[model samples]
Target: PYHSVAACAGLLRAGGFTELADGAQWKLARGGKYFVSKGGSEIMAFIVGGRFCQPGVESGLSIVGAHTDSPCLRLRPNSKVSGAGMLQVGIQTYGGGLWHTWFDRPLGLAGKVVVREAAPGRPDETRLAEKLVRITDPLMILPNLAIHLQSAEERKAFAVNPETHLQPVLCSKMFDDEAGKEASRPEDAGDARHHAALLEVVAKRLGCAPGDIMDADLCLMDSMPACLAGLYEEFISSPRIDNLLSTWAAVQGLCDFAASSAVADCQDVCIAVSFDHEECGSQSTCGADSNSMSVWLESLLGALEVPPLARPLVYAKSFLLSADCAHGVHPNYAAKHQSEHRPDFHKGIVIKTNANQRYATTALTSALFREVCKKADVPVQDFVVRNDSPCGTTIGPIVSSKLGIRTIDIGAPQWAMHSCRETCASSDARHLRALCGAFFESFRNIDTAAAKM
Candidate 1:
């Protein structure tokens, strides 16, 4: 999540965008590009339209939204536990994840850590710090029980109790001997002391004293880097691909749009945003459901000397594309998807729709997106869950309802969405990027087309 924010900020900086203060107001110039971050997890970068600076000239916004957070095992406070001569880290499943896929997988830690910073004026000064700590060559693993230990019925309906089975082993008795009996202390054998030991490890990783580490929000992630797969290298398998793929594509599209010569001709303000906490019902301050996006847009218009009353007019003309990942039909589980709406890998981007507002894709917005994809020379697919199954949602509905903007839900097709590892076609990723770029570049045209219809 931190990487996505940092990467987008880096791209904006490299593209000559000045980073704006969180709530500070400043006048914007025509074609000026600026970015502001909320809670360091949600970021918005915009390129001003040519006519946006003019008074009484209503310019629309072309926006793309995605989320950074993914389903994973989040380490809790006082999380260390010991049993059967092995030290483990206690974890709570953060979202609806395929818990079984995490078994025996190599895991590493990454997240923000709060610490004390020495300040001259404020003796009680404290600030949060970010760190990615890899404890060992093979940091942790949740080993699966042997198949022979289970009955045929049990094997067929295997279910793990996360509280009992998901604890990741951090160390074993063999490692204690290698450390010269350091784990032999009676106090060290206790849970509290085990937690202290874990803190000490974190301190070492941060090059600070244990007491200096105030708190942390670390999560376990697959240690393996994303890479191309398949004999012909047609697939890209990686952790956090569900939404990161969309996040990456949106960032690339924004950067490309900002750098392109087409900005001068574009009549709509192009904005790209990636929020955190979509996995857990977007209720946080930085989530899509929050007022961050609305506040930023209002602030930008205020800085541009536009009257508060006209802001609603601007928003009414805006269009949003909520980009997330869509489930591709698994060959083995084909019955789970609506037969006519089965999305395929490498086929193109998918336009997601739900009769119930689980997705924000309306007929008008979907048509607009289809036109955008048509112009980009990218094919598009449709997705709808089977009648018996419930559909998972994205930031689409939240943002659309929160801001009252015309929105469409779209994403690249992928398999094993919430698994520790997911797969998507490399070509589909490229196609999505092309589609987003076209969406930003031609959304104004699409809006006009929508009006004519």
Candidate 2:
């Protein structure tokens, strides 16, 4: 999930959006397409509309927001664990994941790895570099205990203790057999902290000596690629679909808007934000809870030379669609859903609401979004947690409170949400993109239509 920045940044750059460094001064202009990244995981892209900079222009940003991270198992520091001739990797569960789904599944390794650089530089000092590594091959597996091995109570509950049952087997532990296969030199010796077999696999992927891998931040993932499923291929069976679907859809909409002629006459800034750390909490520099967007906005406003007084108006006028995917009503456990507010697959966008402020949606925002969807001819639905159930949250409330941006929580329904593998209606992603793109293209006009209200 942390790999999202590279994919999104590449997409933006390919779409003619210039990348801006956070540390550098920004000189934004009307009708410009640009993006900025922070903490290597969070990204924001924008198309500064032609209508920007007019002294009294009422239009503001049409923004879509989603998160990049999801629930998964992360490799702990010093992850090596061996018993009974098998080497296993110690794992730490991240977020509230369905740990049971992870058992007996093929797992791949991915994330940032720190490697050594040229021994001598500037001051002839040894340097290091971080590289993203993803080994697509099925490198590990957490096999479940067989039915015969389980106690009667365990068989019924199938309760998984993450600490006890989550360790994934990497390979056979033939410690003596590896002695001669490993590099012996001080510089050539790989990170002893990790199992030798694991180091060898990663080093092989990087085409470097195992010892070159100094440190790493890796997680286990389903090695299977996402694919179309169902009799008519109407379902998207995949991993990380919960938020990645929203993240991808938002960026695609932004890029489509940037490419279209609408930007030439558009009256508002069009921005797509994919923040990190939402699954856990958005408190990081890259998270929506922080000043990432504010900092970027301040820089842009300063560069565009908007009047100090009008800056507030521009912010006040902005509307943000918080687009984290919602849960679809389960077929087998349909009773668990709110009877009056069940969201079905492929039923279009779900406008999630909560009385306790779990979501940031308000009556006015919901009305505005509904109007936009209606004009665009897109279907819409609503969802609310059962009174007896606790409502889940998204980046909506955080961004709304922090930036004072008008926000509404929205998502396309999906099933098996935090599982190692998940499912979503294939067409729902298309609808989501269409709705977001329509919102970007039509927000200014919609605002005009509702001016009297």
Candidate 3:
């Protein structure tokens, strides 16, 4: 479960994308690829249209979006707490997840840490540092209450209090000597000395003084790495599969298109954007609700020397594919899904729809995606929640409304959505990559067809 935004930036850089700073002037080449990040969590990448500089033909944008965030336990600023002669780390749940599943799992910490950097002549400045600290030797566990101690009713209805039951015990009585030593350091006074041992471990790993650590946005993730599961090894069992799968698929698709000669000869710009905080509402500056995409588009057009009046025409012709994870019908709980609309694993990509606009897929846009899948020889499925069940949303509708561009919501089907571990078919992941590649390669023809209709 790799969750760091800085990590995503590294991958994009390796994929031949030149990073652009805010308000930086850049020249766009025919078939040029570039990317920009907001708060290092949300990222957007673009490929210039091959025919963008042609005389009279208008170029359209083919954009794909996914999110990189997942539900996990985040440590607070003052996270150290001692109880029952044991040192524990205080944690707050970040998003809605299967909390009980997190119990008794080998967890590791990963996220960016903010540190104070002081140079000789310059003023003190704060910088962000990232690290993936693994305490995988089973350092902490939220032990479950014994079943023998619970009533029959209580046993049937399992509940966990995040404030009380979720704290992870790191060690017992071993930190006393470290705490005493920390007390002698001037910067480690008061509550800071409480978790001196833990800070010392992190400081050592980061190669920084303990006092330079200002704060962190650390999250506890399952220590287990992604691997194939099932009798025939047909399923992928991993953490953050709900969205990281989509992010990976989108990146693979864009890279495939960029390497193809067909894409280099085309006139449509292709993009893949992965945002953070979609697990929570996307209200941050880097979120879909923000003007990050819009501003970037305008800048690109300006660099291409497109007239201001022609920008709206370019947007009107643009299309966005919002890829996220879709729920697969569980074998044991098939009845929980809509009777006729249950999406199955390994079948194909799922097209999500909601009349209430929870999903942005309309008849035209959904058909556009289906046509793309058909061209790629990929199977397609449909998913709509049961009438009695509440619908979940994605960045589809948010980006659609924000840019007023035609959009469709789609994803690879998966099981155990918010669990510490989730399941999906490896075949479906491959199919999504092909589908997105076909979309980026053939979107120009699709746009012309849709325009005629």
Candidate 4:
């Protein structure tokens, strides 16, 4: 997660956005237009006018919302703990996760930091925004209880509880034994004391003052890198592919669109945003539910100052593609997915459907996506949550309500979405990129009556 955010920030810098005071946060504007992407691959784009050219012309804000954060366990501040002569670091699951899959994997930590300097009452502040600090030396480990200690029923039914079992080993603390035995040192056993000690440890690692440490949001991720796996190398096994694949594809697509003139009259501003905290509900400043995108879009519109009628025209004409990830049916658990609705890897973009509208993809938007895919010569697939099951969500509906723009929820299908390592097809990345590019270039005046019909 930390590396992905840094990479995204670098991409945004390459596109010319000034980094905001808040470490990884950044913004860029051109004329009356704006484009923003957080940590870099997650993007949200905006435009001011073109309203007069189309009906219901209110605004021309075309949003493509994708999340930068994925499911993973975050190390707690006082994560270090010792048990029965063993040392471990406490971990809390950041989002809904596939808990059992996390056991026994090599893990690393990464996140942004606010460093403080020596000063009584007022510490000097320095933020290491996108700097990912990884402590890979057995920083944590969760050991499973032995089967011999449990009843047959207990052994047969295993459950993972984040408050306990997910903690990782941080190594021995025996070096402190002699110092503690030596004297005037008081016995330390409070959360605050532990937090202070950990903060000091972090400060020492960064060469900053212990007082300089402020607030931080960090997570422990699998030390494993994304790799091509399976027989014949047919799949990609990596951490956070649930949406990173879409984030990468969208960034690649936007870059491609910006460099091409093949699709003309294409002055609709381009944007790519990857907001933070999407794994949980998106209610933060950097989330879809917040004012970040809203404020940014309004500022871009004010800068553009399109003709009054053009605002409405832009809305009537504009579109949004909520690029998220979809679930590929597990062959072993095939009954959990609709047979006809299963999407194959490397095939193309997958149009997701949840009758409850858990997904923002509508009939009209899906058709539009299909048209774009057809025009781009990209193969496409469809996904529907099985009747007996409830599906997870994405950034689609949140952005739709926040911006009030037409949107189609789409993604590349993959397996084990919230696991420590997820899998997907290799070819879908390129195919999705092309489809997104085509959609961006082809967005213009659309027949609403025909669309509605």
Candidate 5:
């Protein structure tokens, strides 16, 4: 679990969504609002439609899928690496991050630590507890090498080697005595692999003894707050803007729709799922590649007592809007984008297409989403990769393939993806939210019309 996972939980609870346990028997009610996930990093919320719950009536799902992960440096076990009286923590690049951008920046460590509790009768058996930890006050830094030390080629474009250059400095050896005394540790052999100062900070944050923390899934986070930039604050300068913005848009869209009068007329189940591990291959248990969606959907319909034979019909009627982020044409690197299909910021949501099936978008899905945007009065854009460039993929293809749902890939336009920081138009987020809301409210009716043709 990370900071965003906790905040997401709070937001869903505040939005009047009840949580369901993934392993327990579901007792869902008609027009009920619910969320379910097995881990902290994953969340899926849904509102059952009253109209669809009627006996013998067919309905489907309108899902908006986004990812909760971003590229960053994750701490490794036995991270303690020290030399010349200065301590540094070893880190492995978690995803395809711009290695150079992380240099010389203030960094915070935040993630879940598995705390161990002694079992009374068994020394080898311990109960594990997870505590979310954050050392957010710039306690670490990955300073860049001085420019004078760079080669001519490096000076022109900074390049970084992840193994040697990315480990962040934590503290000096001077704190070894003082912080170590305060953070009492076990005499276990593996305990020496962690820096005392690092453990001290995590211990203080969680108000637990340092020795209790057996293992951690810590990562380096940029210690910068997202802010408005550009003339009149037209742009949002932030970290994790690529997918976080889309996650927010999906949740906000659902909340806004649930509060509006149109919700009562919605005939399909509306859902928003923010999955983890998308930055990687999304193969984890909570990832979109997993059977999480299919399992939960089947369970929900089973709980609703939908006939086994009619379950396939519900899947056919479902649709998914795979919301990620679109690469806006960068002013300095405009040639990298397809000339006629480059998306711009604040213009609206971008419909992404790839001939190689990198995206799940089809003519049918695009037409439906376009009408949704039109009904919402939100502008829309399109994105296509250049013929010579390789296209990035999203959860759309995987989920659409698994569930056979009519799916389209879409996003808010952004710049500098996979960097320490990124930028995007402020209005694009609002447009995305509006489009999502309209899609949830109108997708069923629109799909019905499309089917008639």
Candidate 6:
């Protein structure tokens, strides 16, 4: 939703930054101070620099990166179909989502709409902002096959069909034959009329013309609000916690690092990036693989007038912390993880590594992170993918390759990473915050000579 972006933008603005909107681009920068950007969720990044630089020396940059987008069902452009005399919204799986998890739950729709806004001279250059629409009432439910329909064997052996098993009922409108009769002509009626009717309702709420809307990237979200759950209420049970947990930690760390640096005279820049589309792939413009972060960094360096040759020196001595959510060993699926490699809830930060380089964590990077953690008295842990099991990669490798900086991947332990409602230990959230803060603080103090070696 637009509100979420606004909330994040508010944080950046409050931290002393002037906001800029260049068409669809949303950038917030402090006058010779800090910077943050929402590259339309495919990526989001922020830079904190402009104070604490040696005279005639641009500050070295310390970067933290994460992804903003999560796995969910996306409504296709022509997502209208009729079944059993009722209308349903057609959809396809957006990422590697657990299909069964989406059945029979109350779902809401929210996203951005590319609409034709009032502009002078160039109507083609229409402005863009997020348009969030929610179907608050339970108008749709994906009813699972009844036990009668599925033989005992079939019930246990059935796999979901994205086309058939995931259709969402559009409520009474689907069965309103009298209304359908009044709106049945394709030229004069039918699904188009129905859709138009629905749009009228949506347009009324948005206060815009239906024809003004060009395209949409709508998401079906669980209607449930985030809350504290568990027998002792010691854990956070929320939607999108897999990466949100790390994201919140990263933001907190940047805030803490900036506040701490208020009086220090250090020649280093600190940044926190939360990119989008990581759940699917980091290929979008807002993704870590894209040039969004690079563009911002280069601009800052240019503004600071750093020599091109010295840029490599800054990177060689620089460090990037890739914050993502790591799997905590599940009690039910304990065998899925190696005994020693399994991370515990609220234990400490998890250092994710892959021999195949799926992760950016290497011996050298881990060693540096360990040093920072040690100096801050922060506890740390390690995680390696089970040899036979495929591992999920993060933005760590992408940024490392793009900027040639030493990158380390870290996350808090959590359950149900891609579920609508995910869970994480409350203590782990706070622990990750402390760990990231320490890294941001210590990164500026590391001896460049020693770090390079």
Strongest candidate by lDDT: 2
Candidate 3, which segments miss by more than 4 Å at Cα? 1-4, 118-137, 174-194, 451-453
Clashes in model 3: which pairs?
none
For 367-389, candidate 2 gives per-residue lDDT tens digits of: 99999899778899999999998
Model 5 misses residue 279 by how many Å?
Answer: 1.0
Order the candidates by TM-score, highest first.
Answer: 2, 5, 3, 1, 6, 4
Model 4: per-residue lDDT, tens digit, 1-453?
556656765665575444443233334333223345454323454332233223333224444557788888876765556676655666678888898888877776667665544445546644433234555444455567788888888777787767867777654456445433212223452223233345555666677654555556667777777788988887889988877888777766765665565324444665666676788898776677877776665545444555655555555555778888888778888878888998877778889888787888888888877877877899989999878887878778887776677777889888998888899888887787887667666654332334463
Off by over 4 Å in 5: 53-58, 117-126, 175-190, 451-453
Tens-digit lDDT track for model 3 on 1-453?
Answer: 334455556766787878888668878888788887777677777788778747877677889999888889988888978788888899989878899999888777777666656554556655545544545345567778898999998889887878998998777765665557445566736438337777776777777877777777778878878899899999999999879888877877887787788856787788888888888888878778888888888888889888898878788888999999999999999999999999998899999999999999999998888888888999999999999999999999999998899999999999998999999999999999998889988877876776545
Residue 196, model 6: lDDT of: 54
Please identify which of the two predictions, 1 or 6, would achieve the higher lDDT against the true structure: 1
Which window of 10 residues has the lowest lDDT sum in candidate 2? 180-189
| Candidate 5, pairs of clashing residues | none
What TM-score, over all chains together, does every model reach?
0.92, 0.95, 0.93, 0.83, 0.94, 0.88
197-289 per-residue lDDT for model 6 (tens digits):
445445656788765566667777777778888889888987778676776677667666666644245466766678777777778866777
Candidate with more favorable, higher lDDT: 3 or 4? 3
Error of 6 at 284 (Å): 2.1
Residues 214-308 of candidate 5: C-alpha lDDT, one tens digit per residue: 89888888887789999799999998897889888888888877787776666788999888999899999989999988899888888989889
How many angstroms is residue 320 displaced in model 4 relative to the true structure, after the best TM-score fit? 1.8
TM-score (C-alpha, index-matched) for candidate 2: 0.95
Candidate 6 differs from the real structure by a C-alpha RMSD in angstroms, to one decimal, of 3.6
Candidate numbers, best lDDT first, in rank order:
2, 5, 1, 3, 6, 4
Q: Please report, as a residue range, the 10-residue window in candidate 6 with the lowest summed lDDT.
A: 22-31
